[model samples]
Target: MSVVKPLPNYLVQRYRGWKATTYDNNKAWYRHLSNEGQHPRAMIISCCDSRVHVTAIFGADSGEFFIHRNIANLVPPYEPDGGRHGTSAAVEYAVTALKVAHIVVVGHSSCGGVKGCHDMCSGHAPALEEPTSFVGRWMDVLRPGYERVKDIEDEAERVRALEYEAVKTSIDNLMTFPFVKESVESDLLTLHGLWNNIAEGALEQLDPKTGSFVPV
Candidate 1:
């Protein structure tokens, strides 16, 4: 028998409520999207943190943005070694198939994945260093970012800096893909990096010229 369980009561009730209200009100739009298909303007790659609501933050409607969420919003260098690469696949589809004009990497403050990476890199979390640990292997993508920020004296500040590096690192890695690099060089696509301060509701955007994050 299939082991997948039904959604919990709260989520079921919430879905019903949404269907009754929001879905009901937007039936025409939903139908149009279903029939015509989605033609989103941008692709947003963000951390899988529950607190970072990508759609809500930008007030984006359904089919407005193609989004992919992963731990620390990381993008690994292009390695076409016949490996199972979910993030890379998503990016490939977005750029090649969907033809998205912009690709945004969104990182957030107080990200658990970023914290875990920080701890692991600093030698405070030995468990994450184990070869068998899936999270450890995944977080290895951010080690270079951690190396850049390891010298920061303050613990909180260092973690925060690492968070920014995560965004920068992903953007840098994105260019490693030949398709992405070609599109960028042809001026057909653009890249953006953003960091959101969860509590303060503040957003900072990366300035490509200065390599700094400034308030948006």
Candidate 2:
């Protein structure tokens, strides 16, 4: 027997409300989208943190962006070893298939994954170091980023620096893919790194020229 359960009452109510209002009001537009298919302009790689609302951040409507969310928003270096790579697969489809013009790696403040990476790298979280921990293996992608910010004396500042490094590191890893590199060199695609201050509602974008993050 299956153990699946239905949605909670609140979510059911919310869905009904949206179906009755928003969906009803935009029936034609929704039908048009269904018929025409999605043609998003950019691909956004963002952290899985619930607080980071990718669409709301840019006030983007449906089908405006191809978004992928993962822990710490870290992208591993291109490894054609034939392993199960969800993030890489998404990138491949977005770039080679969808042909998105831009790819953005977004990191944010108060990221639990980033914090776990920091803790594990600092030898403060032993459980994450275990071989059985999936999160530990996933966070290994950010080890380089942690190395860059490990020496910072202040704990808060160090974590924040690591967050920014996470974005930069992911962008670097993204360029490792042959298609990504080709698209970038040919000027067919652009790469961007962004860091969001969750509490302050502020965003900082990486300035490639200076290799620094500045207000967007």
- Give residue 164's error in model 1 in angstroms: 0.4
TM-score of 2: 0.98
lDDT of each: 0.97, 0.95
lDDT of 2: 0.95
Positional deviation of residue 125's Cα in model 1 after best superposition, in angstroms:
0.7
Root-mean-square deviation (CA) per prediction: 0.9, 0.9
lDDT tens digits, residue span 1-216, model 1:
599998999999999999999999999999999999999999999999999998999999999999999999999999999999999999999999999999999999999999999999989999999999988899999999999999999999999999999999999999999999999999999999999999999999999999999999
lDDT by residue for model 2 (1-216), tens: 478988899999999999999899989988888999988999999999999998999999878999999999989999999899999999999999999999999999999999999999999999999999999999999999999989999999999999999999999999999999999999999999999999999999999999889999
lDDT of 1 at 94: 98
Error of 1 at 14 (Å): 1.1
At residue 47, candidate 2 shows an lDDT of 91
Per-candidate TM-score against the hidden true structure = 0.98, 0.98
Q: Which segments of candidate 2 are over 4 A away from where they belong?
A: none
- Distance from true position, residue 22, model 2, in Å? 1.3
